[model samples]
Target: MTFPLIKHVRAFVVRGGGADYHDQGSGHWIDDHIATPMSRYPEYRQSRQSFGINVLGTLVVEIEAADGTVGFAVTTGGEPAAYIVEKHLARFLEGASVTDYEKIWDQMYFSTQFYGRKGLVVNALSGVDLALWDLLGKLRKEPVYQLLGGKVREELQFYATSSRPDLSKKLGFIGGKMPLHHGPAEGEEGLKKNIAELAEMRERVGDDFWLMLDCWMSLDLNYATRLAHEAHKHGLKWIEEALSPDDYWGYRDLKKNAPKGMLVTTGEHEATRWGFRMLLEMDCCDIIQPDVGWCGGITELIKISALADARGVMVIPHGSSVYSYHFVITRHNSPFAEFLMMAPDADKVVPMFNPLLLDEPVPVNGRLKLDDKPGFGVQLNPACKLHRPYTH
Candidate 1:
């Protein structure tokens, strides 16, 4: 019995929502109410759908072993990521062994140094890295968590990130993270409205249940500090991504000024260990949320989590579905999971990237049960309409 060699790499841009119903989702990732440096026109806020292009579709990556074993993962890289994988990255990985993940990851990271390092390049690299982990796990006949040093806990509790916290409470989730619709541009009145909304939710879910705000990198240092301070009275567990990931100073200020017992979390958009070093070293946030599909995959997350562990900070990978779920189960630092309420109504618990992944286990009563399935315990949906948006 010989180990299989990595013989093939493939990437695809697949979407949902319109017809085949894949990449079709919406959020406040880029709101006109938020005056980012890129777009500050006061009139831009007049048209609500102006910056909706921020929501790119999904990019799927696959690595096939010489023995015909196939491992795959998905992320939000779209066609640009597909181009990188099929054109540049495949050449470096085609002849490597399944166990050559670290070296291969380095080659991918350094080879794309000119145009890569952050944003979609790291995202593509993350997809490839994740596929490699799944490949290695399949080769070893073990779950990814087992390969990552076995499970630290038997099951994972989940907090729902959705607009309807009241419905989430009914679903038996531990907590509900509401997305903040207003930003600093909305003015002090917006701040009061945001806090009032939290107060409303607090009144609804009562004192025991956890209620947090996912500001989605829109609030400023003062606004975030104030939100945390005011919302703390209502028992807001944490304030997440209140400012941009690059705003280390803002994070520092927010953390310093936050109410005692309140937690600050960021890093959903931060990449690699070096980027995370700034976050940990600055003592920016209490929890670091690295998306496994974007933060250098499981390969880099292990390193990032190690950094967080040493600094006594929790590493909660963003809602990357099974990609994060597998890694979360392996570490003690990642005490709980964040489940993005992907159901159209945000009431039911469906697979995070519904229709894109087969066998992706969503949480059952806010807890996910992992069997001894090989790899990340997920398979790509054959029904998914994959499009190669570029030739490489």
Candidate 2:
């Protein structure tokens, strides 16, 4: 049965409790925090904080039809994107057809043309697009992946990504990532220190389990090579975001120097299929890590996955496994979803859709299992009371 065209599109700006949520460390793209309580909460003190902290805002788009069928979506990121959705995109989207997502995306992109593409505008668009897709899936009574096409695999695998090796091992994750730290002394010493840390983590996690490191865009080719070489001795499987995104040639060089069987994955900050195309064409990375929320939502992610798959590249999405759960379940090529280990506070504030046990590693044997629930399979916690709503 064909669904009716959308009758109304309403956008709500929801503020949750937290401090300044935007000030993520330099070079990290897409701040996924709820911004609220700058005044009410003492944690909002920016003086004590170096990064943007707080639940900025959640842009929830609800699409309704004549038959009373409704769909909902929520965008991550902080206040800036939320403002765009509430003040800008919502009016333009009202009464628009839900099925015409491409048209809607194009119109929104053009409307914000003067502002340029990427960054906050695209981030906002990502959220709205996700919500629309969720609504569509609900309308059809199918999971978002099935609506996209069909499942690629019966289950999706996940990597236990964290900086803390002890916690990861205690949590029962076979594969874990070490958080990227700055070079110990800022130059060569720091680089040596980083290699040493990875070597230590390797000793901790043992040789059989998968071990990786996120450089967090803090290394040059020379330093990365040094670290990768040391990492290989301890059986480090992959190194993520080792070089800055602008260092394409450097990555090519690093890839050449990197030990065989060691994979390089990136694209958490990269936008759209075009950005990924450049990465693939350049042979910049072996694995692709696209955040479904930031890398143009599920709509664009599916396309990006296809692009990666064609090249035999693995697609492992970054952040909030809850949002990515359905997509991972459906997409065959996406091998795993990253579970952030340093996000206990964030998770406590915005809990997972289906919280994983500390004992059972996600993907018992390299296969992820998704809860059979509708609309991203997530429900907001009632305990975390909303502070205020943004109205245009």
Top TM-score: which candidate number?
1
Lowest summed-lDDT stretch of 10 residues in model 1?
29-38
Reference-based TM-score of each model:
0.93, 0.81
- lDDT by residue (tens digit), candidate 1, 1-392: 46878888988887773111224444522222433322334555532345544355788888999999999878877877889999899988898887888899999999999998899899999999989988888988999999999888999899898878888989989999987766777788878888898999999998999998888777778878888888999999999998888899999989989988999999988999999999999999999999888889899999999999999999888887888888898899999998887766687887777787778788888898788999988887888789877654
Candidate 2 lDDT tens digits, 334-374? 76666654344221112222221111223443345665555
- Among these predictions, the greatest lDDT belongs to 1
Error of 2 at 305 (Å): 1.2
Q: What Cα-based lDDT does every candidate model obtain?
A: 0.83, 0.64
Q: After superposition, how far is residue 149 of candidate 2 from its true place, in Å?
A: 2.3
TM-score (C-alpha, index-matched) for candidate 2: 0.81
